[model samples]
Target: MALPSVGTRVTYPAGDLIARARVLHVEPVATDDGERLAVLLDTTSIHPVDAGWPDQPADAGVITVIDGAALTVLDAIVAATDGETLHLGRDIPVRKGTEGWAFVVAHLVDAGSAIAEGDEVETRADALLRASLSRGHTACHLASLALNRALADRWTKDPRRDPLGSPDFDAAAIASSRIEPNGSVDRYRLNKSLRRAGFDATVFTGEYGADELRAAEASIDDTLATWIAGGGDIRIERDGDLLTDRRQWAADLEGGTARLFCGGTHATSLADLGDVRVRLELVDDDGTPTLVMTTRAHAPS
Candidate 1:
């Protein structure tokens, strides 16, 4: 079958939980004696990983047919093809607009299904689960900005700026960011290069007493509390619906607009967050210094 020539129109950015769509393609996938099926719909509300980033994982859901039959969507991933063969997940050869390729969301199901091309499937993501992930993702972003601000004084040299217009400590030092159900873990690297970049390494007070860490934690909380109470608006800005399209997290704060290029779900407003907090820990793992920030968001019932 010919591959889909255009990107999938995604509705998840608007907080859509369910969508009725036409099956554009269905292909059988086999790996190491195991088999799986990839289903592509004309439109989908299920958010897929960008393959490029993969920060926030896919939402849990199922596909329901007109006859009320359902197939549990075991996994959802971004697939792209160069008009030759469908490339699933990280196997995509080139970047998004490498000429003839079309990017799509590949909903993975059990192999040997009766589903075929032209079948209409109702796609639904678990709403409560989505909400929890959204909260986690949003809180993660907020914590990053706060952490950057708390560490801004360490960067002596002029560095890039963050969404809040502070020195881009987070962007420069960040290693990985993963979003979970109602929380997230962000890892940052502090190494010699950071010192070479004029970032004051002494700011990390492993040698300092407990009182200093507590004071720093209190400061971060104060900053977070102010931002949350200020009620910043959260919105995702995107260029297209394709899985690899450019998207950003825009937060409207008191002074100005704070935006970060992101591919994740988020709450509509800070008001949706009941209590958001973070715990910062500094650890030396295998001779490499790492900073871990754990963030949590409590949703009001």
Candidate 2:
């Protein structure tokens, strides 16, 4: 089957959960559990988990065919192709926007499914799940900024600054970030590289370490609470509707407006985040000390 030459248009960035689209292509793909069908659509509202940064998982949803049949989407992933072969998720070789390559959203379904190319379909993402994930994602970003501010004094040397004008500790130290329903966990490494960069990790060790950690957590919570109470407007800005287009998350906070390059969906405003809090922990990662920040969002009723 011929593949799409252009990147798939996406609507998830705008918080869209449902869309009508036409099937552009279908290819059988081999997986660990055997074969599955990779369904490509001309446009999709489903938010596929990115291979490059799999922080937020794919949106759960189903596709309804014109004949009244509905097929559950087992998984949705970012797939890329050069018109000859389809590469799904982590298997993608080149970076997005590579010359002559098309980035698309591939909805994985049962192998023997009846979905086919040229078929008209209705794609619907679970609204509740999307909303929950959006809240979590927004909370995650806010917590990162608050954490940066909380640790600003620890940076002895001048380093990069975040959108909020604090030393960019989150960007410099983040190892992994996972967004779950109503919450997120971010892990940061405090190894020699960070120490060399003038980040004082000693504040997380020794007798007074626990006390210091608690103070930092308290500071982050206070900041988050104030931001949420301010109820600032939040939005995602994008260069285009295509999957590979540049996108950013922007918010108006008490300090000022902040923007960061991000591709995940987020809550419409700070008020939607409700009460946000964060817990901090220091753990040993293979003899190296690591910092874990867990943030939770309690949406207002």
Q: What lDDT tens digits, residue by residue, belong to model 2 across residues 1-301?
A: 5999998999999999999999999999997877999999999999999979999999999999988689999999999999999999999999998999999999999999998899999999999999999999999999999999999999889999999999999999999999999999999999999999999999997679989989999999999999988999999999999999999999999989999999999999999988899999999999889999999999999
> Model-by-model lDDT, in order?
0.83, 0.94
Candidate 2 TM-score versus the reference: 0.98
lDDT of model 2 at position 240: 97
Name the 10 consecutive residues with the lowest summed lDDT in model 2.
Answer: 204-213
Query: Each model's TM-score?
Result: 0.94, 0.98
lDDT of model 1, residue 27? 91
Best by TM-score: 2
Over 4 Å off, model 2: none
Show model 1 residue runs off by greater than 4 Å.
31-33, 209-212
Task: Tally clashes: model 1.
Answer: 0
